[model samples]
Target chain A: MVEGKKYRQFRVNKHLKRLMAKHYALGRYQRYWGRPLHRKLAWITSGAPVELLRAFKIYSVYPEQYGAICSTAKATEKLCQAAEAAGYSQDLCSYARSHIGSILRPDLAPMQGLPKPDLLVACNNICGTVLKWYEALAHLLKVPLLVLDTPYLPGELTEHAHQYVLEQLQNMVRQLENLTGRKLDMQDLKRQMARSAEMTKFWREIRELAQAHPSPLNGPDLFIQMAPIVAVRGSQEGIDYYRKLKAETEERVRRGEGAILEEKTRLVWDNIAIWPKLFNFTKMFTERGACFVTDTYSGGWAAELASGDPLESLAATYTNIFLNRSPEFRARQMIELVEAYEADGFVMHSNRSCKPYSLVQEVIRRRVMEKTGVPGLMVEADMADPRAYAEESVRTRVEAFLETLQAL
Target chain B: MEDFFVGVDIGSLTAKVVLVDAQGQALAWAVDRSGYSGRDVAQRLTQEILEEKGIKVEQIKVTVATGYGRVTYPAEREVSEITCQAKGIAHFFPGARTVIDIGGQDSKVIKVLPGGKVIDFAMNDKCAAGTGRFLEVMAGALEVSLEEVGALAVKAEEHKAISSFCTVFAESEVISHVSAGALKPDILAGVCDSVAARVSALVERVGLEPDVVFTGGVAKNAGVAKALSEQIGYPLLIPENPQITAALGAALLAWGMG
Candidate 1:
């Protein structure tokens, strides 16, 4: 096996760790400060309109991100088993299974589970499983649940679909007003959206910096640096963290410093990361001088918020998430990434836990390869569940994929 | 001193070593069960082949290793089986565009260019349902010798259908067929079809092209080759000694190093 040199780390990672730590710390002690400050803590999905929650002065935490944490911490298998023991099928999303299992067995969870939520918010733009997943959460926690239904876009985002999502956001605001005993603050929402748009722009720029020869970042960097964007999207802290990340990434590009010591092949990644083996899996590529210059998963958060009315923008932005779009759009997105990054090839993680993302990958892979004239390799593994991963099989595919690229 | 090149493939079930002259002509080869240590078995096989050819270790220009145990074997270079399979197949069938290889534990389909350059490929995910191990288990259940399985399956008037994709579950299905008075030949034919069906899906993922070549130890089973060919609607080209192609490819690659 060719053992490639270790990838360089950014100085900004220290700041990133501190920022994420503070965010989690605040959540862990939310009860003490939250009640006195009249800020309600609500558990929200990653795709939910978090800006609206911010507008209502609601403290939001992400179970989806927590699921990723559980996986990285090596607690996912046990947590998933706990949920399975509780009648949840093993076939369910590993994230949902792990999060629910954390609730069932806090002792096995990282931080003994997230601070109890006063309410639960879910959006179906990411997947339909979240609807049932959150519904189950509401029943278990005996909390009010608010859902935003985003209609799937078979083609372009139709007017009716936009209006439907806009109406749901309005209803969610009303429900939030009732839950928090606060009024909908329009100015506050505008400010939140502005911060979100700025943070997203920084993230997009950080990703674009990789377009330089020998990309400034690799797959793990993208996955790790995306934490604040996912956890505190509309917050000033999130914006500040991204600014530092953008500067560090820019400096790497300015110095012509690739993420790894040598980048013989540049590639694009598709789907969620294999968190349980994030570093190990990435090492297989880096060891072969292959760097994932960009990816569709983290870049999902880099799209700028739509302009115009803040509410409509939130509606459109949240509803038109790439996951909810058609395979044609996804194929185009991948092809554009390959061209934009000048990647040699691409790899799609056929994540067993994510049906919406994994199901159409083969179709998108073929289309992208045909249009871009680059090879795309498919690897079957779960995003969080290590049990689904086969080390030997994955190694073979990765090696062969890299060998093909080298041969070319 | 004559210049020689050697290729060693330490697979899950068998270890193969192929020795070639400087001109890339096959000189000698051998195969043996991988047993508990494929690397050791591969080393032993390589030594035996060299001794048989009366070629000393220093006479060999390069030794390239491949297969699952390629990493652990001592060699000048190690390449993946996919690349080796493509190189080996292209050497025999220059017009071959696709290659299907079923080893002991995994199966893969590779799309290759004219010169054996791999453009794309797909493999069976962490499952034993469509591999040589799957066949060995079924053969054990049917009380049929592994070598006799293909011959018996070919004579079946009507083949049974094995619905389960799991190896263990498929074995139970085979046992139930026996209890239901199904002929062993018919049941064995079902086993081949089941393996073929699983591999056929993988071939579809890579998109089969004309002049497909079948390699790996499983290719020795005529029953699977016929079933897979029928399923994909394309005749398969099997090498005389199918198991050693990867080793031969490795040896060919070693020759290129000079």
Candidate 2:
């Protein structure tokens, strides 16, 4: 049988599929894996070890978590420059740069000369760029790649799209069998999907704990805990990792250990973090006892949304995200999270490199505030391109805005 | 008995209205700063352009709106700027297959199929790396108005090209060069060269098989357009009102539908 253009459909999900490694990372962190530290900071390097842990059914780490790691570490220049020199220009994406760096310089690898991937898995939901990036790497490393197809259903996934995703999930099992040289029992895939469903439900509980008068965990802490969830999601390891992270979060809530900052004002952040300035920005908030209760970066959920019906859930999780939607949809999403978390303000990052995400931010912010009476502050910066961020400019704007929000 | 079809591009910074007669020749057009009220602006501009040409709005077969602000006014159809530019170039120069549009906020490189369908394209909307907005800043610092930026560049035979790819750095770099007594035209040429280098990368990405059509507000600058054409090794066909190319394409789309 000849594979045609339709087979190319399966490759679209390669981005999210490779991100299953984040679930693997989550499994590691949840169980406390090899104690890998990238920048010698407990939170920064905790993500890489979580990747290994999930393989042992320990934890899962979010890929974005690693993106955050590279952002704050500020050492991704060589790999990004190489990618540009190789013909991928600034128009691509920063996430593409980090992956290129990961492949070319094992020295830049989070593991730092540690073992490379035993397998490569991907999903198409994050963005189209990731699919091509992983494909390039898969060709370079000569590894069997497993892809989970999710249609580009921006607002919501239709029933047809959901069913189609399930069929793709089943087909992936066959691909896995061909590469691993072992037949995947159908019962195993369904069971793994069920475990993921359970874990996503548990993860939501941990986030809702933030709804408690004061957030049980701060933005930085949630940023840390997100590791296990990303490392091993959709597997027993991912399920187990979130189970532990959930437990830790709940225990904190039970003991009334509110997220470090306690204040009257709360804000929801949209777009990517300005890493070079996160320390300065975090201080701006932490010092004032203000909490960034939720952000679009921290918003994507493996919630009940992706539960019981693995295909429906995967489609639900991928298609209905900040990146996939028009500006109107994005505004609704930010507004919903702010209202759910009962946030007082919104700080939107007008990212320089991501036009699709950043273009309508001003309109979204204005419309959201008009409808909901929630104040919104806008900041300009780049997600991964350091050249786009101006530290002094952003600092002055953010500090003044925070002060005004406080006064309100 | 000549009828006209119009394209109105409501851009982020400007609103442009272009009218094409039955033969595809653009008869007249108007470019204005986009105001807060787009619907009002579109209505008023349509009257102004048609009256200016002594033509009535009723004589127009179809009207289309395009641009970032195109979304604001609900039009006959909201065709994408990508599609509009490809079509606008195809309509203007029958042999034109490539278009380099450097707008106020973002820049785009488009490739047109024979029928004006966009076969492949690339854009640099996320940064100021290669956009007219960057030059607008450079023009400000050099004390040589934006209007003379392109013309002045044509005269500079021995000017140092600014090395700063960043808009912020380029501003300061231009300042230092001027203080050192560099000719305004030379600095302008250097800036035009910088924009050309960046635009060329995107054009190459789309596999630039000419004839090329340089259309945008920036294309009005003879020096910059000349610089871009030289860099690409082809003479560019500059439409009469390049700024409304996107909106013109949008109007053409509406005419096709009706």
Winning model by lDDT: 1
Interface Cα root-mean-square deviation for all models: 0.6, 16.3
Residue A339: error of model 1 in Å?
0.5
TM-score of 1: 0.98
* Segments of candidate 1 deviating more than 4 angstroms: A1-5
| A25-102: candidate 2 lDDT, tens digit per residue | 443343244334211101111112122122222222333455555666775555567667777777677756655665
- Give the C-alpha miss distance for residue B122 in model 2, angstroms: 28
Report the lDDT tens digits of candidate 1 across residue range A1-408: 124447998888899999999999999999999999999999999999999999998889999999999999999999999999999999999999999999999999999999999999999999999999999999999999999999999998888999999998888888888888999989989988898988899899999999999899999999999999999887888888888888888888889999998899999999999999999999999888899999999999998898669989988898889999999999999999999999999999999999999999999999999999999999999999999999988988999999988852
The C-alpha TM-scores of every prediction are 0.98, 0.54
Tens digits of per-residue lDDT for model 1, B130-199: 9999999999998888888888888888999999998889999999999999999999999999999999
Q: lDDT (CA) for every model shown?
A: 0.93, 0.65
